[model samples]
Every structure is written in C-alpha cells, then in structure tokens.
Target: MVISNKALRFIIATFVICLPFISMANPEKDTTIVQTVVAHEGAEASHEAHAEPTDVKSKVKAFIKHHVLDSHEFSFFQDDETGVHYGFSLPIIIYDNGFQIFSSSKFEHGEAVAESNGNFYKINHHDGKIYKTDAAGTITEDEKSGHPTNVRPLDLSITKSVLSILIAAVLMFFIFTGLAKSYAKNNGIASGAGRIFEPVVLFIRDEIAIPNIGEKHYKKYMSYLLTIFFFILFLNIFGLMPFGINVTGNLTITFSLAILTFLITNLTANKNYWGHIFWMPGVPKPMRIVLAPIELLGVVIKPFSLMIRLYANIFAGHIVLMSIIGLMFIFKSWIGSSLSFGLSFALSILEILVAFLQAYIFTLLSALYFGMAVEEHHHEEAHH
Candidate 1:
C-alpha cells in the first residue's frame, strides 16, 4: 500500500490531466447546463421569476457559495424540467414551542414550507437559515434593515459539515485500529494500510514530537499529537473531494480544534512554565510584572492563530480553485477554456499538497506549545 514518491506524483499528474476530458464526457453536467440555459430564458420572460438566472458568472458564483455552505440535504444533481432533486434529506430537528422532528425534504429544497406541530417553517435561501413563518411561508422583513423578523427556533440538525465530521471520526477509528492490529500480528511490523501510514506516523514522532517536545515528555502527548495530525489530514482531504464536504473549512470546526489544544496546553503546564510566564527568573521585578499580562495574552493568541490559519487557508484554497475552474465556463473559446483547465489542474495538485502541509503545520505548532509548557529550567546548569 506504500506508494513511492515518484509513483504518487505521476498518478496525481495523470488524474489532473484527465479530469477535464472526464468532466466533458459527463452527460449530467451537459444536461444541467442546458437546463440552466432554458430556465434562464423562461425566467426572463416572467416578471415575478425568483429562480436563479443562468448568467455564466452569476451561476459560477452561486455554485461556489452553495458548495461553501452547509446544507440540509446531499444534492448530487437536479432535473430542472421535472423539478426533481436527486438527493437524500437529513433529519431536521427544531425546538420552537416544542421539539419538532421532520425530514428536510418536507421543505422541498427550500421551495416549500414545512409544517410541524401546526407551525410553518421556511429556510431562507440567502443565508441558509430556517425561520418561523405563516402557512404561506411569508418571511416578514424590517423595512429599515431589510432583515428577516421571523422567529428562529433552536436548530439541532445534522448538517453536511456535521455529518462529514462523524464520517471522518468513524473512518479514523477503523483505520488506526486496523493498523494497530497489523502491527501486533506482524511482530511489531506494519502490514496492509499500516505500511502506508507507518511512515507518516514515524515522521510526526521523529521530526515533530521528539524535536519539539523532548523524548522524556513526548510519549505523554504522542496520542494527542498523532490524533490531531491525522484528524486534520483526513478532514482536509475530504474537503477536496467532489462530495462538497467542507468540514475543515468551517470556522466552527477549526475553532473547536483550537480550543482543545488551548485547554490541553494550559492544563498540563509545569510550574516552571507558569513561573516564566508570570514571573521571569532572569528579568527585573517591574519587567516581570509588565510581561505577565502579555504572556497570558499569548496563551489565547496562539490557539486563535491556529484556528484562523487552518480555516483561512482551507477556505481560501476552495474559493480560488473553484473560481479558476469557473473560468472555463466563462471563457467560451477553446484557447481560453483550455488555459483555464490547465491552471485548475495545476492548482488541484497544489491543493493536495496543501492538504498535508496544513495538517503538519498545525500538529508541529501544537507539539511546540506542549514542549514549552513542560520544559524544565535549571538555574545552575543554565549559568554554567
């Protein structure tokens, strides 16, 4: 299962090169485009049309936004003519007056209102938020702010992002457990999928954990470091897939991960770690007092940076890659379209590399923080 570097690169390159042609051959994409064109014309003829127009740039922007947002259902495709969506709906659990559980399909992809316990609810297409409404699904808006005045129930629905996280967690469990079994069965040697992931596991330990956190303390944090590295790695890879699962790109997800690191680092800090922060050994009393608050702020800033770094990189990458691919539709000419495709292909490969890089960076910084927290200082040894 362990692929050589050269072979991996070659496979990625081949896939990139073939992607455009493969997409061109897809009849569903072509059908969707044709339907969009037809729908656009129909909308132009009607004065009260509310459907999305088929302007090339507008459609592209809308598509990107849709992909970026979490949805109530998994939409693989849609037939405009038949007004049918090819997707499965997730359960919608809301607490307004009381608990109301229903299928997302009851909303009919946000085209219709769903009634539960004699209360009607409608999803706002612009923000993807569900709102309480009348039987007609009338969303009252304030004239001054132009914002909805409808009541919003507590939504505890399993959105696309939430579902993706559950999937990733389950996948990691099986993968690592299987790898452990392989090691035990093969006399401490990894077999099957373990062979592929064994090198990466070693890299994190040897290069990241041991170097940053000393060997004496690295083992204590190895489980956490390994878990986070692979967790982020798998989520990043999932975001790149065509399933539109952007778990890592979600700010909430990144923020949660950062919070975990923050809690672990501060909770496990040795006396020396806090001592240097609140009262430095080699510094003046006045300076120590001044630096204490700054060091405390650093604690919050570290995890904040971690959250933003992962979220921004992954989110921006998706936007840029999707925008480049969107250029193909905008450029109708062969030369322009070909150029767009070529740039997209290259960016796609780069995105795969970033998927791993972001995971590594997050893990490395975490290990470094752990190292700093547990580091011991000897005044006599330091003076010598």
Candidate 2:
C-alpha cells in the first residue's frame, strides 16, 4: 500500500523540528570535558583549597576571576588546555569614537581588561569574578563590578527574534509553495503530494472553516484560514529543530498573530455575534447592562489567551530542553551523560508531537473565531 503524503509530510515536519534538540542532547561533554579532567588531576596533585598549581592554569584562573572580580573593565576566560575554546581578543569596550571590539570566539579561559578611571573594571563576569580583558588591560577588585548588558530582549526588537521569524517564513514558503503546485497539478483532485496535504486542508475546510463561518460564507475566509494554519504549522515545526530558534517562543510573535485574529474577527463579525456579546434579547435590561462590561472584556481576553498559550508553551519547552542539557555539565559523571542522552531523546520525541498539536490548536481556534464572526442566528432558527 502507498503511504499517504499527509503522513509523510507530518513525519518529515516532526523530524525537522526534533533534529536540533536531539543533536544538542550531549552538550555537557562538549562544554565541560576539560573541566572534568582538570578536576580529576587536581584531586591527586593537591589537597589545599587553592593549592592546585600556580604555574597558573588558565581555566582555573579564568573561572576564579569571573567569580571574584568586580570592575567593569576586566574579565576572565575558562582556559581550556586543548585550546578548543577560543580566548577573548576583542577589546572589552567598543566605541566608534576611537575604537570598537566585538569578539566572536568561544571564551572559556583567559583574562583581559579595558581601563577607564582610577579603578580597574571587570568585563563579562559571573558572581563577582572577571571573565575577559578590557581595552585598558586591568582587572577589577571586589565591590566594584559593573552591571553587564542583558542580551535578552525586553520589548520585541527584531534583533531578538528576527532570525526565528525569518526561518519560519522561509520554511513556510517552501512547504506551501510545494503544496500549491502539488494541488494545481493534481487539479484539486488530490493526486501525488496533494493526497498527503488534502486531508488536513479538507479538515480545516469542513470542520473548522465551514462550521464556524457557515458554508455560505466560508469560501470568502479560505485564504485566511489556509495562511494562519500553514504559518503556525511552519513555526511550530521550526521550533523543534536542534539548532532551532523558537519564533513562537517570543510573546511578540504570538501577540502579533493574536492581534491579526482579533482584527479579522471583529471586522467580519455579523450583527448577531456582537448582539450576543453586548446585549441578550431574552435577558432583563438590568442583567444586560451588568454583563456588558464582562462580555466586552472577554473579547480582549480571548486574543490575550491565544497569545499567552502559544508563547508560554513554546518558551517553556525551549527552556526545559536547555536546562536539561545544562545539567550534563553540572553532573561531571558518566551517569549524568547517559541519563541526559536518554532524557533528551525522549523530550525530542515529545517536542515533535507538541509541534503538530500546537499548529492544530491554533488553526482550530482561528476557525472557531471565524465561525463566530460569520454565524447567522435567524437563519439557523428558520427551520425550527
């Protein structure tokens, strides 16, 4: 028997999303192998708190400096003996006025500084220690740490989430264009690849679009339903990739989608939907007034729920995966690595499922909105 294109596409989409996380399952080994080796050797060589060896190992020193230093100009590195982790070379401070420095190296060990004022300052640090050097070549003392820049976006900047959005867009274009061609060649007859996608498209058409918008009006809304369904599906799949950046992980994207739904729903809402929301014909005058504000709030809250649901689910998944991978470095043992591999594998599988589920939910909810907007109560009661 021939496998359905829908099933094949679903499987391929799942793989695309899960591949990145599966590949990232063993990040601990790549990140901390040197730290583990040094720890083992140090245990044999010295017993004192700070007596490991002052030939001055880079990793130990950099790690220490990062935790202990407190100035804005100075920083420390992790100091991998294998040189696998690159050291910092960029100036600690970048300014177009006289100079600028943006280091692209993976900084695990070393020290650097930028001097400004009488006191030495630390750059790139955790706790109180310095992590890298500044332009002036000075290290910071405790009680002198400068606040570092938090790279995470606070207000939906493009720099923060553009790549994720772009990835989603590109993936959507490829899949949908292929789908469109498949659809046309098959002459809407569901041949070849169209067979795979037809059911899903049909599902949206029959269950979502027709029921919600009513068959008479559903045709007008088909393009919007198709766009929302595929856009969400593409983003959901992209979120699952190992190297994946979560587009839906950001509230901004979700909020934007919600706003679009809100606009379309309200713009297209028939007389009955609004009447039911603001005034009930059977209800007492006093009761209608009391319910009006609550009903109005629901309109806003409905889209708000849409935004939060998608953002929270996607964000939580990414954070959980990152944290689990981070644990591998913290464990410092074979058991940790082994357990991480298994857990990561399982989670990757689950993420695949979540990708499809989220897409379905978004599409389903959107359809429901469209249905509410276009529903006609008088027409429904005519038979009765």
Candidate 3:
C-alpha cells in the first residue's frame, strides 16, 4: 500500500517535470523563435568563416571539445543575444591557505574572474579548469608547454559531476527504500514499484551474481555488486539527460570505481587467491617464478581495463555524437547537414543501449573477479 503511494508520488513528480513542455500551446513557434535567434547569431559569428571550411572546422572542434568536458557550473542552455544562462550555478569551494566560498556565476560563464577571500581565480574556459591568477587575471603560459604558470588551489567545489552523484544517491535511496517497503508489505510477493526493480534484481542475482560468484558466496558480495550496478546505471542514465554531467565518462570517476573493485577483490580474497598470485602450487619452481610477475601484473591490468573500458566508451560516444551534431551547423548544405543529423540521431539511440550494456559488463566482470578470489583449489592441491 505504501509502495503504491510512493509510486503515485513518483508519477506526479514526473508529471510536474513534464508540465512545462506540455503546457506550451505552440512549441513549434517557440522552437522557430529560438532557431531564428540561433541562425542570426551563428551567421554573425561565422560570417568570415563562411568562405573558409578550415575556420568552420576549427570552431566546430572547439565547440565539441567544450561540450564533452566537465564544468564548474551547470548550464542547461544559453541565449546568444543577451548571454543569459538558463540553469543554476554551482558553488565554488577552494582551499587556498583558507577557504574560499563563492558562486561559479562570479566568473560570469567563464568570461570573468571570481574573487573571494582576497584571492582571485579564473576558469580556463579553454579547458574548464580553474587556476589562481593575479587581481589583473593574467595567465602566462610557458612556450615549451602549453600549461599555465599559475598556482592552483585544492578545489572542493560541488560541480555538476558532484551534483549528479548526490542526485543519483538520493534517487536510489528513495527507490530502493520504497521497493523494500513494498516487498515487506506484500510478504515476499513483488508489489507496486517493487515489481519493476524485482525483475532487474533477480536478473542480476541469477544471470550475473550467482552465475559468476556462485550461490553460496554470491549473497556476501551482492551488496557491493548491487550498489555499484545501480550507482553506475544511474550515472549512465543521467548522462543521457541534458544535465551537462558526464560522470561515468570522467576518468576520475571510472578510476575511483575500479579502485574500489580492486580493493574489495584483493582484500576479501581467500588464501587460495593469493597462493595463485604469488606462487602457483602445481607449477614447477622455475615456471612459478616466471609466472608470478605476470599474475601480479594481471591484477593491475584488470582494474585498469575496467576503468579504460567504461571511460573510453562513454567519452568517445559523447565526443562523436556532439561532434556530428556540431557538424550540422558547419555543413550548411542540405545533404551534409541531413547526413550529420541522421547519424547523430542514430548514435543517440545507440548511446542508450551502451548506457545499460556498460553497467552490465562492469557488474559482470566484478562478480567474476569476486568468484575467482573465493574459489577453492582443493582438487589442485590434491593433484599436486
């Protein structure tokens, strides 16, 4: 009964979110207005570039690069004429001798410097990184290296990525808690929203968890697997939204997740697992020595592969999709513009599949690693 209530609430919340789009009496006219504004501004910016394909290509590349990277502030959309942003700005927190707290809006969408606590900082809009600069805000770059010669503080700002994580965490809490309550109320039978998650939970347990980690030990690791699976799955789905956060696509995020798996797999591993890593029991002494390094190297490679696989796939997808969409503006010709638009639409659909597939693969591999760690080599010991 409570589950049903929660489900209704969720539906209502979704409706509230959709109300704006639905309330629009003439979306076509609104779109036409926006497009008319965009074309007017874009033509002004690229008037000289209209004759030069190289100039257009450079502009497109820069635009796509900017789109894929993480940013301090969250921006849904911007107006070309008045330079108005249609999203909430994030808080900027930096530790430079003392704490500096300010809004990212202080930078005015990266066109200005933000000063707080007598310290001035500038966003390298070129790369979306923050750096400390003088009051005059001068960024000196070394001729040898393109990096700026400026001090950088420890930034603990709640960026779009951080906000997305917090959002996902809260969303999961509500969902799973409601699902749990519903399941409890039904006395083992799935009820309300539980019916939705029930199938996915069972699929993970049956096809991924139990099959990979064995029935006995699977339950022990289910918490970790489920947590990661849902967290990553939520992140993947969130990236598909126009929220300006590419959490999973960020290497730091994938790396952190991979490290967690690595630590859990190695730390919880049984004696048998280490025995296989350091020295193979059945193998000859000389062979074991040669194989030991390879086995150890494999440990590092496993997590590295996990990180790279997720980061590369998501990052590349975002880049390619955006680049193609950017090309629609560059290639004004009907044929080229249509081709780019079609490719972008097709890839957007593919990205949805990839979003789910990556979550599955990461969970599957983590479970496999867990199984290997807990597996007993009794038969091998007997043979030796």
Considering every candidate listed, which one attains the maximal lDDT?
1
Clashes of each: 0, 51, 0
**Clashing residue pairs for model 1:** none
TM-score of 3: 0.84
Cα displacement (angstroms), candidate 3, residue 191, comes to 2.7
Candidate 2: what lDDT? Answer: 0.62
C-alpha lDDT (0 to 100) for residue 154 of candidate 2: 18
Q: Which candidate would rank higher by TM-score, 1 or 2?
A: 1
| Tens-digit lDDT track of model 2 for 183-273 | 6877665454445766888888988888777779889888888877777777777666543355777676889999998998899998998
Each candidate: RMSD: 8.5, 12.8, 12.3
User: What does the lDDT read for residue 48 in candidate 2?
Assistant: 41
The digit string of per-residue lDDT tens for model 1 on 156-250 reads 99888888878888988888899999989989988887678899999999999999999899998999999999999999998888767788898
In candidate 3 the C-alpha lDDT for residue 209 amounts to 91
Q: What is the TM-score of each candidate against the true structure?
A: 0.84, 0.60, 0.84
Which portions of model 1 show Cα errors greater than 4 Å? 1-51, 142-146, 380-384
Q: Residue 367: error of model 2 in Å?
A: 1.2
